[model samples]
Target chain A: METGPIKQKLEQQWQDLSLQLRAIPINPLERKWATIALLIAALFIGIIMIDALVHGINAPSNVETIDSARLHLSEEFAEDNLGVQTDGSGLITVRMVAGRYSFFPKHIDVPAETPVTFRWVSLDVLHGVHIPMTNMSTMIVPGYVAQVTTTFPKPGDYPVLCNEYCGLGHNHMWSNISVIAKEDWAAPVKSAIAGGPENE
Target chain B: MNDAAVRKLALGHLWVAFGAFILACFMGEYQVLERSGLIDALESSSVYFASVSTHGVLMAFVLTTFFIMGFGYYIATTSLKQPLWNQPLAWGGFWVAVAGVVLAAIPLLTGNASVLYTFYPPIQAHVVFYIGATLLIVGSWVWCLIMIVMFSRWKQANPGQPVPLAMFATTANALLWLWTSAGVALEVLFQLIPLALGWIDSIDPGLARTLFAWTLHPIVYFWLIPAYTAFYVFVPKQAGGFLFSDEVARAAFIILVVFGLPIGFHHLYMDPEQAAGWKLLHGFGTFVVSLPTFVTGFTVIASLEIAGRLRGGKGLFGWIGSLPWTNSMVLAVILSLLMLIFGGFGGLVNASYAMNAMVHNTAWVPGHFHLIFAGTTVIMYFAVAYYLWPILLKKPLFSREMALVQLWTWFIGMTILTTPWHILGLLGQPRRISSVVYNNLLTLSWDPYELAMIVGGLVLLGSACLFIYNLAKTQLSPVQDGFVQEIEYAEPLHAVTSLPEYLNDFKLWNKVIAVLMFISFGVPILQFFFIDTFGSSAWGY
Candidate 1:
């Protein structure tokens, strides 16, 4: 493993390089450029934050604490309120409890062209509800009620998947959003009441 | 200085670091293969997670800690022209950290500590694992103390002089790590240990995550400063030119240590405990931190440009072509910067307040970090090892050609591995999944990417092996003629005879960090104790 000639070549190259470098010199970084870069970066990120605000990105900022242990017994998250509920103003609120490996009320039914608020709480660990192809996703952290409001402009089946890892069956944790016509949403409700919840 | 004593100590650390690195590389390949659902025989969730946890710790904690400590020792001694502040204590820290790693490896390997490296509990691991990890941090704290002490002692001896750039940067990392580790130290000592020992019934995940976030982001800078140190201090000399600007390099280090600490809450943007206001503030801080990275890139590239032009290159970008690509250090910097460009873009996307929704918690997160850590940072570590091994061992590199091949393969393999991983995230593939075996259309879409990742992982595994082999051969080979090399610190184009106190010393910056950390984290963390928050019981062992 001898390279006498190669070693000499490298040494010669080094000397030549030093000589060439000494001939022409340039300063790479200027303090003004650094300041400018920082200012521009701050401004760029600021614009994004403003855009986020405008687009209702942080709509879930309204902080509300919840007793995660007794979520099932709580009035807002009771079994009766586990599905869709429509108010007088025709706005629908979908409440669900997100736990390990499942989002309860696996099927969410809503009406198109109507404002809907998806509110949920994690029973254990951190779970995130990310609906593919839409701007609706919020984290379900235990001891806090997570809320995000949006409207389904068009009727479609949107799969709601838990993007965050929550133990073993995380991959299996997914639900379906059944956004139907406004007229269709009314019929299922009326029929359920008339038939007595169990029969329906 | 007793050069032999220092070299022996440094070599011991490097060996351990590389030993951990090689083992983790094997595990990394296994993880990618297992998660890709490419092989049914390798599909055990418990085993896969155990492997991932060990892999993450060995690479992230053990490898980086040992390597940085070793490099810092050699740099502090040679650059300052002084003996190590304390030799026996350095060896003591080494053994204690080794003991911690051994203790932790038991649980990690046996699947008792299958909780991923993040260890965001509710999902608890064995009590021994937490204790072992705590000891590791405590051991590294010893190194941090030595670095600061050495820096101070050198300054006391030589007043108003610019601490050598290498030592200055090393000391900054020491300060950064001391502050960084405190967050997780508090969490582990008070919350995790008690819960794991069954002394407490439950632990608050929010508080735990808040604390980990403090360590999580800056720990990256801790791993990175060494790589940056190499860029500022080694690359220019290796490229056959002087450093572009010493002052710019100093400022970059100052800003990195200052801004790196408080911006960690961005990791908690999707978590529940912290308010959006705090997350937004942290997000802004995250953006501010990018400035130093840009400064580093500009300074290093300009240094290279000068090197190339001096080597008889022409034009604005012709310097790129003229660079000494055959040199391992020069080649690695080019590849590292290339990776940083993409990785840094991914970082900005992650830092974006709203756009984060698109990529948060998905495969994108892993992809982005892999590109940054393993690609940009680890590749430079390889370069540094190649550059330093001969000097440390008093032997010529066994094979320079092999080193070049390894760097190229690492760059190519990282590209193949992470590109598909990022795409899978965009396709809604979640991270930390053991397998994506569902044969649905969406899951099937990930198949090609998964296959690409397997090929990439295998290539990376081969490259990693080559790197270790080359270093081992270099160290074991008999001493050669012309092999006696001394440490060479890059000189700046413009001489720096003196520097301001703030640049030369970290005392003022330390106070600034304290104030910033308190302002950013004080309320968010204290509120956990102040409020009547419920704790979740242990769900996993």
Candidate 2:
């Protein structure tokens, strides 16, 4: 081929390639359906998530009554004498005075597989009781007792936090919760916060 | 100064904006990773908190405030077909504002102020922090005054002619901001500063929160009105279509400014500062503001439909495809609207008086805000920068393909970052946490989403770098492609050559605002003097 004809042939080939790449047609109905499906899926996913996270998917345990569960939580964490695990496991009691707080048996020597309940009441601003391990949570207000019940599935150290955005030091006000093995709670265990008279 | 000088002025503003944006991008990536808690090296609470605060202030405060003031001056001059009335004062405002940002950055970068952007206190920062922030807002107030004056002067000089749509919207924003910033200005000057400096014995937190609430809701409109102005005035012309309705556009601006006020209590819904009745009144007002959004939506979409129809598309929604997808402005609107739907829905849930309990103070708030502010509003800012910079600089874009890529990545990255954030929020994960120290089921459930966010952040960071690179090249390119394009505004469909004094005016709007503020806030605010209420003890000092 002559030089001019060769240049024309290359130009024609590039045009064919451009047309092929740019000509991919999109279907309208398919696109609409895809958007609709994605939206519906997002909605369903949101519902399932909230159902699992907030309202929760699993039903509240097969325990007989809410009243009974409240009682267990209330007695275990009261500031007065509380129901201890008879297996020599210590009990914890918490009280709020004005805006200050004091705890009885702040560090509990609780046995493994034993369920501990927190009975909390706020004297001032609203407070939330949250234990992240077992997802146990409740809210406490002035004169209104709120309780949370959870079993220590493992012997480890965990923090119990006040999740509410209360005044200040909200982050620093958390306390420690230690889970002891069944054998340790049966005997005497060293406590982080000793049950001393001066602490009161 | 000549037109060349004005062009240089506009270019400088855009250059600073892109510079701040790229720094913000890297900070964003670092944040997502630090918050994720997967990598030990990237985990530093001090750095994370400081970075988050600085990133938010830069993007939300510095970037938007400076960009808006600069663009407003230019738009006011060009759209009204006049020179800036007070150039020296405008430049003075610029310097003062820039100085404030530098002062604020000293404490922020050094970790003296880690108030995590929102600065809702009891959480005290250095006194210089509060002072710096005050100066920034004060500088903007000067710009706002200048704008309102220019609008008034323009109307005086050229009466009976329809003042351009762009100038009208800019003036509306200036007036809206004047009313809007006063709330926070009073709060900061009176309460926050005194509290931070130990001058006040006890701050009335209820009043402070209420004042902040007054400024809270409408600030979004301050960011949004500019974006909407571009949508109505610039995008239509760029898409090769006429504006659907000039009157409807003006009505939307009026409604946004008027109803945008008196709806501040939605932020106070959870606070005891405002009573239930007042909050409800504000709640109802919040719902009313959504009406103008719908009005804008219909008008803009209807305008797009006309463009599509004229371009030979048939059917109701078929016109969506007929839109000029290759055009950056049109593409940006499509993406912006997509984000608005998701973010707006999140806002609906947030605004739902009853449902607010579900996600209150959760990660959802940040997620919703980031999507709306960053994805929806800032992306449109990008579109504006792209459109304006070329004309203002008298140079062709260095890379159109790169701009499109950057915009797409930004949208995708925002979705990735925020979707997980909202889910985590709903799952009971709190916001403003430096890290998750516990290895528990609930915290563990957040791991996957946090990882996604980190990845998304990286993508966004890369995209940000690309954006700055493109703009930099366009400005400093060796190839001098001389392209001089004057600003072309969208013409109203009905061709409103002449307008009534009331229709093409803010004089009536100003009077209406005076009466509205008196009726809505007069008694409620005055009640503080008469009522016997306890105040909060000085907790900050």
Q: What are the per-residue Cα lDDT tens digits for candidate 2 across B96-175?
A: 77778888889989887777555655456687887888888888888898898888888888877778999989988998
DockQ of every candidate: 0.20, 0.03
Identify the candidate with maximal TM-score. Answer: 1
- B25-121, model 1: which lDDT tens digit per residue? 9999998888877778988887888898899999999999999999999999999999998899999999999999998999999999987788868
Question: Candidate 1: where is the Cα deviation over 4 Å?
Answer: A1-29, A52-56, A112-114, A152-155, A181-200, B437-440
Q: Give candidate 2 regions above 4 Å deviation.
A: A1-200, B479-481, B500-502, B518-541
Docking class of 1: incorrect
Worst 10 residues of 1 chain A by lDDT: A191-200
Considering every candidate listed, which one attains the maximal DockQ?
1
What TM-score does model 2 achieve against the real structure?
A: 0.77
Given the true complex, what DockQ would model 1 score? 0.20
